[model samples]
Target: MNALETNGLSKEYTGNWGKRTKVSALNGLTIQVEHGQIYGFLGPNGAGKSTTIKLLLGLIAPTAGTGSLFGISIHDKRARERVGFLPEDPSFCAYLRADEFLDLCGKVLHMDREQRKKRIAETLQMVGLPDKATTRISQFSRGMLQRIGLAQALMNKPDLVVLDEPLNGLDPYGRKELKALLQVQKSQGKTVFFSSHILSDVQEMCDQVGILNRGQLVECGKLKEMLPVRNVRLKVSTMDMDTVNRLEPLVASMTREHHHWIIQLEGASRTDEVCAILRGHAQQSIEITRTTETLEEFFFRRIEENNLERGITRPEPIMAMAEA
Candidate 1:
C-alpha cells in the first residue's frame, strides 16, 4: 500500500465576510507517495501548497474527495499516529525547557513515560540540542528553535515525515545536517514528504515531485523524466577556420578562446551529424558533454505557461477567484 494517497482532494473556504469569504484554495488534487521515497512538493506563492498540507494532516476538512495514510482514512486518529509533521512556523511554550516540551509532545502521542525519556534524549541528540536539555525554549535562537521543533516532530519515530518550508530558518550547516538526516530516514525505510521553495535542495534529494500552480497540479513525475539531458556541448581544439565555417550552420552556438573551440548543438542527434563532418580532422582532442534543464528553469517555465493558459498575467490574490 502507498504511504500516502489523495484523490480529487479539494478545499474551498467559507467565511462570513471580506474577499476571503469563499476561496477555492485547492482543486481536484490527486497524488500518491510511496514508502521509503523522498517526495518534494513544490509550488509558487498562493498555489494551494499550504491548503494541501492542512488537508493531509486533518487540520481542515476538504470540500470534496478524500485522503488516506497507509491505507487508513486521514480522519482516523490511528493514521495520524504514524505520521510526523513540522509546520512552516511552529511556536511552543516559551516557559518550558527543551526536554519538557518534547516530553509533553511524546505524551500526546501516547508514548509511555519510560519511552518518552529515552526517546526525548535520543531526539535531542539527533537535532543537536543535547547540550540544551535544561535550557528554556525562550532562550533559544531562531535556528535553535527550528531544531527543537524538528526534535519534537521526530520523538515518535513516525513512518512518514511531512514538513512545510522546513529549510526556511536554517543556515548552510543546519541545512546540510537536515539533508543528511532525511537521507538517514530514507535508509531506515521511512517516507519523507516536504514542501520547500528551495529548488536546488529539492533537485538534489527528491525521488519524485509534484508541482502546483493556481490551485492545481501542473506537473508531477520522477525527477529523471522531468529534467532529461536536452543540449550537447562539443569542445575541440586546433580546428581550422574552414572546418569552423562548415560547422556554423549545424550548431546552435560556436565560440573560440585561444586554441580551444567550443560548440553547442541543439540535441544529441545533431552531434552525430557534426561528428561526421570532422571524422578525419587532425584535432588535438574532442570532448562532448550533455546538459539538462535545472529545476528552477523547469519550475518557472511551467508556472509561466500555466499562468498564461489561465489568463493570469501575474500572481493574483486569493480573492481574485473567490465566490461568496
Candidate 2:
C-alpha cells in the first residue's frame, strides 16, 4: 500500500476580509509515497510545503481535492493513528523533562503505562537522547530539542513518519545520527516523508524527491532518474602547458590543481577526444570521471526553466522602470 497519496490537493487563504484577496498556498499537488521509502519534499520558503503538510494532517482542510494516509482518508481520525509527525518548529512545555514529554505523547496515543515506559526508553535511545531523559527541556540545546522532538514522533511506533525540516538546528554529529535513525526506520518497513531545505541531506537520504515551486509540484521522481548527466571530469597529470593550451578550447571548462588539471567536458561523447589529446601529449596518468548535476543544480535549473516557461522575469530596477 502507498504510505501517502494526494490528488489535486490545494489550499488557499484570504488575505483581508474586506479586500477578499486570495493567496494560493498550495495548488493541485499530486504525489505518492510508497511504503518503506524515504520521500523528500523540497521547496523554497513559502512554496506550500507547510500548507501541504497541514492539509495531510487534517489540521487544515484543503480548498480543493483530497489526500490519504495508508489508504485511509486524511480526514479520518484513524488515519492519524498510523502516522507520526514532527513540525518545522516544535514546542514543548519548558518545565517538562524529556521522558515526561514522551510519556505525555504516549498517553495522547492511548498507550498504557507499561507500554509508554518501554517505548519511551527505546525512542530516547533511538534518537541518541537516552542520557537526557531526566534533563529539563528548557536546558536542552537546539540539537537536543530536535532529537527529543523526533523521539516523541517515534514514540507512537507509527507506520508513517511525517517530518518538516527534520534536520533543522542539528550539528554535523546530530545530523549524521538522525540520518542513521531514518535509515533504521526504512529498514523496519516504515515510510518517511519529510520536507527539508537542506538539499544535500535530501540528495543523500531520499529514495524519491518532489520539488515544489510557487505551491505547484514542478518535478517528482526517483533521485537517480531525475538527475540528468551533465559533464565528464577528466583529471590528468604530467600534461605539458603546450598540450593544455591546445586542448582548452575543446573542453567546457578546466581548472588547475596543485599537480593535476581537472577538465570538464560537456558530455561523455567527448571522452574519446579528450583521451586522444592526453595520449598525444604523452600523458599516461589520466583519470576520466563522469559527474552529474547535483540536487542543488538541478533544483535551480528546474525553477529557472519554470519561470522562463511562464514568462516570469525579475522586475526592472527603479531607474529602468521610471525610464520605461
Residue-pair clashes per prediction, in order, are: 0, 0
Whose TM-score is greatest here?
A: 1
Report residue 38 deviation for candidate 2 (angstroms): 0.8
lDDT of 1 by residue, 1-324 (tens): 999999999999897666556878899999999999999999988889889998999999999989999999988877888899998788989999999999999889889999999999999988877899999999998999889988988998989999988888899988988999899999999999999999999999999999999789999978888885679998887777788889888889988878788889875778887876666566667888988889999999999999899898884658866852
- For every candidate, C-alpha RMSD to the true structure in Å: 5.1, 5.2
Off by over 4 Å in 1: 17-20, 234-263, 268-288, 315-324
Models 1 onward score TM values of 0.83, 0.81
- Candidate 2 TM-score over all chains jointly: 0.81
Best by lDDT: 2
Please give, for residues 198-271, the per-residue lDDT of candidate 2 as tens digits: 99989999999999988889999899888887888889877788888878889998888998889888967778
